[model samples]
Target: MMGNRRPFKAAIIEFNPCLNNLNDNIKHLLKEVTEAAEKGAKLIVTPEMATTGYHYENRRALKPYIDTIPGKTTAAFEKVAKHYQTHIVIGMAEVDVEDGLYYNSAVLIGPDGYIGKYRKIHQWATENSWASWGDMGVPVYETEIGNISMIICMDASYFESARIAAVNGADILCFPTNSTGGSLSMLQAWAEMNGLYVLGANRSNTEKGYHMIGASTVWSPNGEKLAETSYIEEEKTRNETTIIYAEIDPAEYDNRSKRRLQSRQPDLYGDLMLHIGPWDFTKYELIKEAEDVQGNEMSNCAALLQYTPVIGDKKANLSKIKSLLKDTAAETKPKKGLLSLVVCPELSLTGPVHSLELTAIQQLGETDHDETVNEMQKLACMYQTHLVFGMIESDSHALYNTVMLLTPAGDIAAKARKLHVTESDERWATPGKDIVVTSTKGVGRVGLMVGYDAAFPETAGVMAVNHADFIIVPSCWHGDYGKEMALHTKMMENKYPTNTMTTWDAMARFAQAKTLIANFTGTKLGCRGGSAIYTLDPIYGGETPIVASSDKEEVLVVAIAQTEKDCWFDQNKLLLSRRTHYYRPLVKKFEHVPMLDCN
Candidate 1:
């Protein structure tokens, strides 16, 4: 407990089924959870499929017992949770209307009413015929007991599920299982690896006639086996009966629970739409280089993240920005009068690292403002080029990290702010919820996603579907880009040529691959440092931009061609061919207060 902590209590209930008897099943659960809370417990986690049991072998024969998430099963638990001033995470079957299928879902309810529902993503052997997977990815909930994440009977097998929960900072992870020994070991392994407390609620008996060994157990984040119901060890198939009881200190689970941002490389996911059309097989050739160019090939793009030190000498930083932009203008020179565009990073004028009171530069200071931009516009208008850059956008109580893009016509096209803020930025910034996209006159539809904005793969995916030909990410990061790069490289190694790879090469490769995601944002988070263009696959020379790691200011140039190859997501075969979840981080549980997040 920390200064003035709200100490919440939790218990694990032993569930045994009386085949299809909902009345008796309800009576037993109410008795067990009520007794636990009467002793001051605030939450009680129940066993998996305890109400109807896991006897799906005859499910089609007994459709009468089936129900929806908001039906009787959920209604019963809702009343119980509220009456006790406690919370309950209950497992039940749901007929998902989205896909017209039944799914094993866990519902959480506070004293008030329903909290949220987590439909099981993974299913057991015969479960496929009975249910459909939940497409929300993962549903993590906050409760009076603690910030919790649930994995149904079979969901815990995948390492990514637990990794995601730990990565997002879960304190108490509740697992409601309807399994025996082999499955029990798997749950224990997950809890130890994640370094989060877990409650294992296994049914004593199932309607399917399988006898549960009923070794209801609990484990700390570290793999240490802590408590289990006192029972005679027996074969998993043997039927047994026992009630597990233990007093757990929620604060103990809070140890080793710290979260921070490293590099989140979200671009590798293939879910985003990056082309003007979804693989219409249009007229464009794969340009291996300038020599391989066709009439329809568009020039590569230059996406820049401008930077100035928060407290350093302003004159020097601004001068550096000017020199960098000048070089960038020279590099994106388009052939035959059609220029490549420049999309700049957010807060390039005044540093994004400081408070509004310190770094808010309202104007570019006369000569520094329109004078420099006029020069940029003249170059764009002269060389027939474009640029989307950033400036200090401020008004009253706020300042924004904006992207300023100039077309060949030499005018501002689009602007947006960083949508999310971590602890490091909460003291200084506000949130931008929606994304911004602009249709550049000749360049097609282009979108903007700030640094933190890219961490969520959906941001890019949504833009891609809406008509974005390309996306710009101008970022600044102090997190680990090495491990993520290595991970992504290993995943895509066999699928694509290694080309040039040191740790730096892999970092750049993963960043672009993640962003160019055909259907899902590839591992949506930043995995490398530096800034550059993301050319979708089949455009030739691979998918990433120039790998930039040095603190020194520089400009990167990429020529994006208008190709006939469709965006990956629309082409299921293409998406299936590549390992989209490339380079995922996996780690053992650290057991300490600050747990390991596969970093």
Candidate 2:
């Protein structure tokens, strides 16, 4: 058994295979595996459909390339694994000969021979046209090197795939993909959020009409890139073969993984399992068409107030907030039928607190009936808009970091206490239990989250499952902290800064929801004020923030159109595509993974 014996090498092979050329592709894959194994890589992975290639016209076109487990392809890979005494993961189109079913699958081969396989669960639109939905659930295999899990190309787009692997005790997530855009950021977010290593082996060059960006990468548990291939836009440079390696030490960040598991409130994630969207795949029927969908035609003018709050000075902060609200109301008037939404940063009333003392927390905390809330309600009424902002709420003896929504009707529509709290918040604030989504006059259903809560995909996922049209975030988020900063820097360098708007952008794309984040500009308090609004980009199948703020105080306003026409597939097709029955691990209490020493 390879029991926690220091750090071992892991390799990701980025290769572009010829369509339907199985023999040549297998020969090339074997050569790469041999080279990586000789270079001391105990764990080696290849891109999705490495042997057969991606983007087939239909099932008949792919049928010739499909092989059953323990078939010829597995036999060839098993020889390499046994010879090198290494574990190899390869993506291929698998056919269950008995059932005559085809699936996009990844097979894991150990030194002993065939170990296990994970069928791609979440299918992209193109994949749905041919491959059947993965029937085998996400599985983690206990190996001497540590627990390992495998997920294919499109599965990386969904948070539940990685989250399930993590909860199942996977130390390393091997992702083999033929994905084109924004793939690295998605992998990094998965690594950071799940607190596990993500090794993505992506193909290079264009297959058919789909251009796969060759940036195979290995991410540490902290989401830091250990190694990555260059992502050149030039078609010629994109086809180059590359092999990136990173040392895998499963125990290095086991604590972070353990903490994430312990902090998960699975009971509150019931929505994740329910078919609660416009279309229900369980019934194989469309509940609403694009035009018939409620709130699709409604456009709301939204303003994000990015400003530093005067610490411990609620009166001053309220004055500045009110001034901004008044200016926003006057400057950007919504159309006659549209509504307006104004969002403020987390702890906008009292700012971020440095004191950990209970008395200090209690003194700074306010109730829904407090003068500050009443003042905000008055502003909402006066401006004839919905106001969203964060504050410290004192409910009896407990202190919670909460985001409140005040409607133009002069009422508190919804209040969502932050479910995922930072270390500093643990000293003075209690983590909330419920996820809140409120239906409004024109905004449809608006969901609420605060600062760090947006970092967790499940939080937004719950809101999305509840059919939230707009997910508003009141955050004091800083740009310099967290492992995501590495990804943020990389994204900024690539001129795709919107991809760095926290994990909310990815969630917005997956959940088909609009996300508006308002943040503070207090450098001293670790807030860098990168407030923005993210929406689904139909052209690229990703997300782009329509309006963004710098590290300075400013009120940015834009008209946000929430439409079902921008759905990932058909009207609400991505929502309908979710295989919730296979997601039992997500809502269950995490069990102790045997491979890692949590203590």
Candidate 3:
């Protein structure tokens, strides 16, 4: 309706479940669906485990609420759908009639009858106890309304689930979730990146001390939020329920999807299907060979420093970097003498400004031949270590948030501008054109990305395919650093957190390469540094991941031996296993798209 002719009206229901009471929940869902249909909603969606309720005491206790599809619950919903001529999607505890196994699943019903279902693939914390792992992968259903797919709760955390469905020709992704603030960022990301509408329905109210915060929402392929419920009210009271609706044209998404597929570099996504296996050393032995190399011969050691720069002070910022580098060299000279490389946060030279006025940020920017870069190059040569830093670059017409990599010889190796520009960045900087991986004399292939660029996997995939030994990310994250780290730790657990495309996930997803991420510290320019070094392969008999100070200036120096062997993938098999032709759907360029702000 907004831009296209034949619009499809879709509705999402957000309400409190009756808690293990299947009958009452079903009745409530049916009422909501009926109301949605009367209001002209062609398709309606409900929250995860809507029928049976979530937060079960035990798997055995959940048996009574679980039933097979086409059973009593589906039959009831089907009758209503048929009467209203509306499509319905709801989550339930599904039981396999033959094997007696249960699954956290979502069922789809149309006017005709039972359509299809999607079992939750990536189970959350408590789910693994009750529901068996999902057997069916991502499945898309075709009907008169549109090509629909479902991803429940934790499944939305996995970008691959949404990607696989989109690649299989899904126009709308219906997500039934029993989650909180953590995943809302990803919901809109999936929609805009895949060029499809996303309908997210989350449960509200408290269940057995476990609170479900509902912010049921919908987004267009262009990354615009069509409608969203109040997350604050949902968390406060059970009386607050939202049944929001939006009108979308499937043809718009179809055209966008075609453009998206045409722009993908599928040949570079070989690691998309790779399983880094596990962190347990049972499968592969640690390379003890690096230990025998002795003294200054260690080529793998690197340093990632957390620095805070004075805003708008280009001279002060350069002095701070020089001081940090000098201190690092002095401290490490007693050990391995010098680290192979050193990395700093984004906009290191100019500091960071969250404004676009040319006068405000332009004065801080300099040409590639500016004295700031030359000084950094001299430092790289002085320490005989590769130096990577972030700065604002001016090229006559535009200013850019750029990352520059300098060789140990004090010569420029490669420079890349940030491709994913933030709203604030657009006011002053232009986006980079492509993902570039530059080879170094001793560092193997090195890839450089700035700030938000790490949020997109395609950028990392391009670097990974180019055989980068490790990727350096210089970021100045703006948020509650304490909360972000806590959430990251809780969400990741001990499992190799590589299932999604977030900065932390990308580290594990591209485990073959050591990912060194550095950020600015303190609240000066609104950054609380949480620098980390991620390596799947253990170094020096300990887990390779380490987090620096949460809100203070710190340096994370770790020994990452340069290895010719693709330790995680077995001779670069991760890059070799990709089905290049099948990934055309992801070919479309999504870098320049600004991220949707979370409500």
Candidate 4:
């Protein structure tokens, strides 16, 4: 029981923790533990602040409720662990008797004894009241089944914590959370990104007037929702407490664990590590963008298809894209001379987004000469229209997030790789170098960006400098619709928060460029489906700038005039603003500075 290295079942308890009532909470928890162990779970996990509950007034109010590491709470769970021959992770408010500090902590109790504890490093909004930031760092505990590590609720928000745990050889990243919506995808993404199993134990029901949405779930390393218990389902079943069970095999994660870390580009990610705070603006040279004269007439009609992509199914994905292209071509045949290009979502061939198996991705990865690209090229030639789509491009050693442009003659006119890649992308694909803008027979100079590249202003800035008349964004922005939309709104506002502008609109209008954004739509990816076409001026005669937008799968065809008009937002001259030298912090590395120091 102390040392067994075999695949075993695990359980995550989703229950309501009574505020400041450890007795009732422990009794309910033990009941779940008994049932889980009876059902053959070798490891069991619980939600954050499982015994003491979350939300305390302050340190003074919380200290009385906080207990020591091997205090009465763990002692009780220890008995259960010993009785069941299983390991248990229990979350509670921890009081360091020596240091006299409180922490949001999770303790690992094995059959042998108390294994270890992990303090929650990243604190959420209200948690700063009593909890001190964790100092133990991310430490892993080796057991017979696998190497295990614990991360409290807010810690999962930062990808670095999970990355740190995985880099240190953690097979299972156990999470104790009091989280609700918008956090689920982040958990799933973390599991897929790190190639480690995740047990997300979230609290359910109302606590002191605050409702915690319970969706306790377990995710496989590949981002598969192995088992889950949602609040809606539980309410229908009239179940106040639920335990989601899963079977984990450490061997399943071995290959990806090595591959994902190997693919990380830390050298290019130094900017991410740099933290910025309020600074003196007068010290830096501030220059407004110079006004630009409207360029020559460059009108071209385009179609943006917000179709769903099938994950890891290359043949099926290609067939879908081809069918859509053919259908779109037929619909626009009467105006064939007008429609210049069709844009598809990122990784349209093998799925715009996926928490895919590394081996499957490598096998499905296609080279430029592969049949995948040739088929798309043929489609472009047959229609006599340019086509741009995303796919997994691979060479001998690496995979790339690539967008391929096909001319009407069936030739690969341009290939642009995604420069800014997410953790999910880094799991399998290598980040691309350099922004590429290429001239098409009818489409004018077009710049390509994939997914998160939209987050960086410099990406669009560089493309704008190249005289691009149009930018095609192929995105795999997957998550809950409302939550992802909120995130996008926040990201778009970070730089220009006071203006309340969409990043895509700002990027397009400020750059004096038109944009055709193609996004995937489906429950499979859980991505917020935001596909639209934007121009400087409204074509439909509405105040809104977007020409066409779709929340679901649809063919959005928009006809643009040949003349490129100066963008409405361009009147502000933000794009032409020449403070390039003053923006050194964006490209150069800087030490982590507290955005707001409370000293």
The model with the greatest lDDT is 2
Superior candidate under TM-score, 3 versus 4: 3
**Any idea how many clashes model 3 has?**
5
Clash pairs detected, candidate 3: 260-588, 263-587, 264-587, 264-588, 300-560
Candidate 3 weakest lDDT stretch, 10 residues: 480-489
Q: What does the lDDT read for residue 347 in candidate 4?
A: 83
Clashes of 4: 9
Write one digit per residue (lDDT tens) for candidate 2, span 217-263: 89888777899887745355466578988998756647564465666
Runs with alpha carbons beyond 4 Å of true place in candidate 1: 1-295, 303-322, 325-339, 352-376, 395-398, 421-434, 455-465, 480-489, 494-528, 533-546, 550-552, 562-568, 571-599
What root-mean-square deviation over C-alphas does model 4 reach?
13.2
Q: Which one wins on TM-score?
A: 2
Q: Per-residue lDDT for 78 in model 3?
A: 90
lDDT per residue as tens, model 3, 1-599: 11223677999999677867889888887888889988989889988888877887677889878889868889998988898888999888999889988999999999889999988877776776888878777788988777789887766544566777777767789999887544554666567666778898887687776666666779786556788876543337564457999997755655443344444445445544444333524223223322343234454467788877777787787787778778877878687555778898898876678743579787777887878788888889998988898988988778889999998898889998988776678788888876777777656567788877765556776666555667888998764111132122222324322212234433434335667788887765677666777654432122436667757776677775654343423215544433343344455333333222212
Clash counts for all predictions: 47, 0, 5, 9
Alpha-carbon TM-score of each model against the true structure? 0.46, 0.89, 0.60, 0.57
Q: What's the residue-level lDDT of 308 in candidate 1?
A: 37
Per-residue error (Å), model 2, residue 412:
1.5
The candidate with the higher lDDT, 2 or 3, is 2
